[model samples]
Target: MAQVRNKQVLLKNYVTGFPKESDMEIVEGSITLKVPEGSSDVVLLKNLYLSCDPYMRILMYKDTPLSLGFQYSPGSPLTAFGVSKVVESGDPKYKKDDLVWGVTKWEEYSLVPSAKILFKIDHTDVPLSYYTGILGMPGMTAYGGFFELGCPKKGEKVFVSAASGAVGQLVGQFAKLTGCYVVGSAGSQEKNKLGFDEAFNYKEESNLDAALKRYFPEGIDIYFENVGGKTLDAVLLNMRSHGRIPVCGMISQYNLSQPEGVTNLANLIYKEIKMQGFIVSQFYPLYPKFLEFILPHIREGKIAYVEDIVEGLEGGPAALVSLFSGQNLGKKIVAIAPE
Candidate 1:
């Protein structure tokens, strides 16, 4: 078998504080075209697209439990959700040329255990990169967190923090589809044009609590928690009675050594607010139903998704680091292959 040059983004060490592009190094590695003989339950992949998600930051910390037992070591390729084509497979459920999206290393090619694969890509009508964003994990996160946990009703007022992000954007749209009034908070106004009932730039707001009040005079019935810290503290004050808050990623607090404390727990009792944190994997069972609901809206132009894509494997480190600086305009993705 011929060996091919595999360009990889290697984690330099367990990260602390904010991550910088210098924390990762791009290096040339080599891999055989075929999976090692007799390696059962392994699949060789030609990685196409790699997703840059905020959850990945948690995985960079030493022995971070957020990784769910997957640990990163110095000089090892960083792991992320990606789209790939199967080059060889030892698993019965997959075969040569199968398209799949799931956990993959940040490299041109990867040999991964089959269990890490979330699902095989069956729908090709949309861009294959969609598997890394709107049609994949982020999509499912929004669906399960909002519809399942949020339990929002028609006419309810909903607020989404980091509303222009991959999952938050979808959550806001889903709220609108449910006949709810939705307002989103983003870092910039240019990135805030995602079909929400109203959107605000959190950076421009002198008081986030007042911003929420301006958007939801009646008070927020649902708050899709994305950015935590002060944003969450503000949302807590504006929550309506019987409100539901599905805690998603808290990007603002992810890199902090000391996470900010929320000061309004008493409001949860007084307002009877239901605030619950969720992991996307817990709701994988609802994926099929979510796809059925979202696909049509996508094809008909009823749904909109934004992606901030960087080209080539060499660009992975800077692209990943850009997330912390809010440099990427939308869902951050790296296109490793032409597809």
Candidate 2:
């Protein structure tokens, strides 16, 4: 095959508060359509779906050290979790036409070095694009965090913050499947209607404590903490005794110079709350278990998911910036190329 290059979205600089479109730049780049002969370590791919997550915002921090997830490097292509088709392979584990999802760069083509991070997509009955959001990282995040950390019983009251986000939406649905009464707090009323039993707009709520009390009259039994500003403070005050709080991403505090402070430590003593923070990588061992549990539901259409896809690498900058402003409808994704 003739070697063809592609376009990519690149980071322009380290970011401050909310990221602006100027922070990212669209540049034409290339990857050899063919893998180098005799090199058995590389896999060449054509990327299709690129995920836009809130964590990507944190990566824009210039001084931030590289962690388990991606960190932004100025003038380099922005990295993200994405789905792609294997066009050429030097690795024996994957070959031509194999579909995969993993930590991929936000470009049309990528030369992935690590086979460990890539998962071959076997279930094509459902949307292959789902690997970017619902059936991918966000799915693992909810399954690991909610089911593993925030153990819920039937008829328990569960609450989720930023309920419309990639992780939050799945968490709410999982709570419902567990036979718990699930309510979500979103920034808008339209998003609140997706899967939540009851949805409230946090901006309209004058007193968050009162709002929580109204929704969870019996106090919250399970709290999926996605937003950790005033909402976390209020949840702490209203938690039922022995309540479980699965501390997911705190999107509300990502851009702040100093994160929001919650002055309710004393409530923990009285409430006996169980609060734990977790990362998806911590649950990689359980990915197969999660797939077994979620794949059936996904294929049967018993479980539903929403995604906000932007076309072309040129839209990557705006799509990412929209996360902080809540401009995206569902899981924000960049479609670098058509399948």
- Judged by TM-score, which candidate is best? 1
**On residues 1-339, what C-alpha lDDT tens digit does candidate 1 reach at each position?**
799999999999889999988899999999989978898899999999999999989999887868454677888999889999999998888999999999999999999999988999999999899999999999899999999999989999999988888898899899999999999888865746588989888889999888888889889999999889999999999999999999998999989999999998899999998999988999988888888998999999999999988999888888888888753468889999876
Give each model a TM-score: 0.98, 0.96
Over 4 Å off, model 1? none
Candidate 2 lDDT (Cα, 0 to 1): 0.85
- Worst lDDT run of 10 residues, candidate 2, spans 63-72
Model 1, position 275, has a per-residue lDDT of 90
